[model samples]
Target: MADLSSNAPANQFRIAVKKQKVWLASALILLVTALLAPDQATESLGFVAKSLTQTGPYLLLSIGIAAWAVATGADNLIARAFTGSPALMIFLAALAGGLSPFCSCGVIPLIAALLTMGVPLSAVMAFWLASPVMDPSMFFLTSGVLGFEFAIAKTLAAIGLGMAGGFIVLALAGTHVLHDALRDGVGNGGCGAAKIRSPKPVVWRFWEQSERVEKFGKEAVKTTLFLAQWLTLAFLLESLMLAYVPAETITSILGGTGIGPIAIATVVGVPAYLNGYAALPLISGLMEQGMASGAGLAFLVAGGVTSLPAAIAVWALVKPRVFALYIGISLGGAFLIGLAYQGWTLL
Candidate 1:
């Protein structure tokens, strides 16, 4: 009636102009502030530098994992591979989890996607426990800070716990739980239900048409966006840890002659999400102040496994009971490993 369609483009243009002005003004303000307040600017710069130093490894790891996920379509590949074999799926999940660079928060979306694709519960459990510990970036950080021997021990312990946890989950809950939880079914096309329905081809027809380019571009953007969100959150967490938590406090809490300190460290680390890279400085400080190797290892394991974000994500996707079981097993396994390390040292 009022030429509504003709005005739509004009409205969009106005909105775009408004957004541009807002951004421009914000940038100008920030620049002026930086010029006027050298101390605040320097402090901000220092904060960024410290955060990068602490969480750079994890950021690199996230990039590597994201690249792999994009290149191989890991979610789809895994779904296809574990179609009928629950046990095999469980093992693969653990392996994938171990290799994945995702932090606790990032791992959840992938896990949820996998579960929706009909992956076995055991495998999902394995991935849940193993991903944080087996990250390559974190491994590099550990090797640098904790030494090669401790790194090896940490890796082995993570894999063992993942495997053991998978079996325990499978035995207690049965494979049907997995099937029921992941009711969407498995396989390449079937796994990507939401994506598949969008009138887009799953496999790239590189030679067929130029439209594939657009599809790939869209996918790249999606992947980047997803990775960026998680990576930013992780970086922020690292910054907080560096700014607030003192090296001396961490050492005093975890270091001592009795098993009480080790146990306390494990418990404290569960809800406290910490970057493996940041732990290096803290560990170095502790060691300089006389903390035991075993105690440090315990802290590392607990921090990696008991991430609150991961636990919440797992709970949302899986049963509350299953989530509780996972937490219990992971905590118990970490404690046992710590105890073993302590005993070996005593021997």
Candidate 2:
């Protein structure tokens, strides 16, 4: 009989290729560009390299902080936001969400945990709205790619959206419109609920524990790879856009000082957004191509909240009506914030 051990290497290679599909696709794109347009390929490579170098420091810091939060178990502290009065919980939950290290996918289980704990839907809605929009790493990445001002505005927009969603749910809660929000069979949040179910005292000095130290190392490496691959793909696409996409086209479509472009952007963002990290460089390139700042903001905000992963999680966890409200709030809040940000820029 043939030895199965002989197949291990090939199997591992296949797994690696499958798992790194984004990187593989990016490489294929670069290869095709090199074969068809050598000069453009070279320029694109340089652009990606230079952009990565410039953003390296911010990337490292963001990764470090995220790893720290995970290793120290501090992320579980978010449960505190649900304990206070409904109004206070809404405010605190929004604030925690903006500052938390969770991502769109990572926040899912936590959301599950909150809901399973019988947390008020209004406060949970606040966290749900804000959590995916802003985080420590996102703020740093945004600042590095866009600007400090833009990052600050995005963070404020996140909190504002959360507040708006929370209060709206609170008002409607009296009518029992959202009373039985969770679906019938939705079980307690999977692994993410463990810490919340059984509180673990966060070890602020996690380095002291060998296991925590190992956890930090793994998290750091994981986050680094995740960010690197996305950013690399982003920069590559940005370079291609700069080389091929017409500036006048972008300007005519998205540059005008009006609500039309922002509205279009909010609508477009739902399907067009790549990933949060990937969109930054793409948006930066769009802005350079005369895409309006307001439009860009709207795109990011809308996409962040309603991206496929997050949207699917929300759909899977909630009743149909509750899911409708979530989508309505996300889209409406995104447009309003986009207009507000645009007006702020004018001032």
Which candidate tops TM-score?
Answer: 2
Where is model 1 poorest over a 10-residue stretch in terms of lDDT? 182-191
Q: What's model 2's overall lDDT?
A: 0.91
Q: After superposition, how far is residue 195 of candidate 2 from its true place, in Å?
A: 2.9
Per-residue CA lDDT of model 1 for 83-173, tens digit only, reads 4577876676676666655667766556665566555677778878887776765565566545667778888778777888988878876
User: Alpha-carbon error at 120 in model 2, in Å?
Assistant: 0.9
lDDT of each: 0.61, 0.91
Poorest 10 consecutive residues by lDDT, candidate 2: 192-201
Q: What is the TM-score of each candidate against the true structure?
A: 0.60, 0.95
Write one digit per residue (lDDT tens) for candidate 2, span 1-347. Answer: 99999999999999999889989988999999999999999999999999999999999989999899989998878877788788999999899888898888888888898788888899989998998899998999999999999999999999999988999999899565797889987778888888567768889999999999999999999999999999999999999999999999999999988999899999999999989999999999999999999999999999999999879878988998999999999999999998998998898
Query: How many pairs in model 1 have backbone atoms within 3 A of each other, for residues 3 or more apart or on separate chains, i.e. clashes?
Result: 1
lDDT of 1 at 29: 42
